[model samples]
Target: MGQLFESVVMAVKAIFQNKTRAFLTMLGIIIGILSVSLMGTAISGIDQVFEKSIESMGQDVLYVEKFPWFMMNDDWWEYRNRPNIEEEYAQQILDRSSTIAFASPSSSRRADVKYGTQAVEAVEINGTTWQEAFITSVKLESGRFFSELEDRYGTRVAVIGYDIKKNLFPDEDPLGNYIMINGNKFRVIGVIAEQGKFLGLMSMDNIVTVPLKAMKSVFGRLRRISISVRPKEGYTVDQAKEELTFIMRGLRKLKPREADNFAINQQEAFRQQFSNIRFAISAVGLGITALSLIVGGIGIMNIMFVSVRERTKEIGIRKAVGAKKSIILFQFLSEAIIISLIGGIIGILITVALVGVVQKFFVAQLSFSLVLISLSVAVLTGIISGIVPANQAARLNPIDAIRYE
Candidate 1:
């Protein structure tokens, strides 16, 4: 322990004596650590962002659609050939499925929504029943959702999203105010609370929802419609999916051997698709980043060799003064380690500052585990770099080394 402490002290002195050279030698290590840490932080941030987006879509809900969310080697034409998903399937699912809580039939179209010329272009106008509010996550910032009577009568009542509220009526209360769509005036009955982006890409807040009956009146009933079903409490998503499959099969009158036409999709699909995406990203990112560490290690080795040559006479002096070969070996090893470790620290600090600046816009968190890993790798790099030069120094003949001017 004493010898190690003494070696560290000597290493510190040596580092301070040639500060500029030491920093230049450590530059590679700094860059390497920066690359590695940045990659880890970026991947972690993406994971967090994905989780939030999926949560917004409602974890318990299953989407019954003609096409699957992810298309993996499956033919799009095959899916297209499958029968269209029916709006009546929602009530049928509710009646027949034991695992289902409630099912809401929903359909959408892109339209320009105007509130006295403050228009939002291409905003998604969703049409669903009053039970739609019960089947999914729909927290209101203002008024209540439309009642069953309102939906049944095709009342021109609408619920708007936060972005629509902001763009259309920034300063006024939107509740009971009339918004025009296709020259038809619909009263705003509720405003949905601000839900952040979907998958960090599209806004969840650019929407206007009305009763399905009212939508059929304006847009007609020819477009695609899908059901969003949630599982009953105490039942797993797998059980709900199984029940949905059976019900759909029975309803469609598929034989024991006939393949079902509809896709039973959930958040797990996103998880699966993202797993592949994450794997691809890590494979490419880590491969490129690892090269930096290797180059840094090589640079450390070359500098340590030069350092050993410069301090040859000092090694001889120490040997003549009763210093053991192990002490001489540990001294250079400690110096090399300190250099790389300091470089790693600097790199980490810079990464932390950079991530902090951008985290508000996106996700970029520097975890403690990543910090430890970077430091550990830096120390390991120093050990590997120092050993050869350290061994050469330890084996030097005292008289020969001292005389080699």
Candidate 2:
């Protein structure tokens, strides 16, 4: 153990003595390890962000809509030709399906909400029943959500999103306060909990939800609804979907051979789609990160070869003093390993800090668990890069090595 410690100390001194060369040699390992570490951290962060967003919208809930939520691409004309699905159909399907526990129809429109002289423009106005809030796992931060009685009565009451509440009523209570939408005056019934935005598109905190019946009265001729469904405790989601399909098919009067008019949005389906995207992103990151490591390894190899040439006389003198070839090999190998290990530590620190900075925008946090992986790869790279040169130095004839200039 003492001898090993002495060898490591000597390697450290040699590195400091040739500081510029040592740093130049370490640059490749540093960059390679850093790239891979950063990539792993970044990918992990993105996955967490996606999971949090999905979780915010209840994991057990599924949707039944006319159009697919995540289609690759569809023609505008095709969308125009699509028939409008009715809310009554969703209720009929829910009533008929034994596997389903509860279901509700949801619709959305863009509207400007005005509070006194202030106006929040282009806020998404959602039309849903009281059950919709429970299905979406939406919790009221203040006041109360619209009751079934309110929906049945078509009351002109609205639930404001957290951001909307903040913007419109910074100090005062939003509940019972009237907000004007176009010419309609609606009383704020509740303020939703602050939820973060998703994919840089929509702000989850900036939406307003009102009763479906009241929305239909104001907007007129409501066509489609975003239906949320929950499966019964004993039944799997697939069974619920199957039963739902049968009910919808019968309701639409479609023949067994004909294609169904509606689409089912399952949570598992979103998970699968997101998983595919995550895998693709991981593959690309790994590929790029691997290239960096490979380049660094090559750099280490080149420097090691030069190091062997420069230390030829030292090896000869050691061999003459009864030092074995293994000692000479170990010395050079240890030096390379030290450089890589130090670089790996630095890389990890930087990568972690970067990931932290990126997570600030989201309500959720990012996590990394690739420290062991980075260290292993770093040490392995160092040993592999040093092998050829270490072997060459060890095999050198002492007599010839001593005589060489």
lDDT of 1 by residue, 106-133 (tens): 8999999999978889989999989888
Supply candidate 2's per-residue lDDT for 295. Answer: 79
Clashing pairs in 1: none
Which stretches of candidate 1 lie above 4 Å from their native place?
1-6, 9-27
TM-score of 1: 0.91
Ten-residue region with minimum lDDT total, candidate 1: 284-293
Q: Pick the candidate with the highest lDDT.
A: 1
lDDT of each: 0.88, 0.80
Clashes of each: 0, 0
Which pairs of residues collide in candidate 2? none
lDDT of 2 by residue, 1-405 (tens): 676676788778878898888777777777777777776776666676677678777867778787776765654446446566778876797778898887888899888999998899988889988788767777889889899999999899999999899899989988999998766889999999988766433679889999999888888866577788888788987888888888878887899898866778876777888888878877887787687777778887888888889988888887888768887888888888887787787777776676677666633232445888888899999898878888898898999887767
Cα shift from native, residue 218, model 1 (Å): 2.0
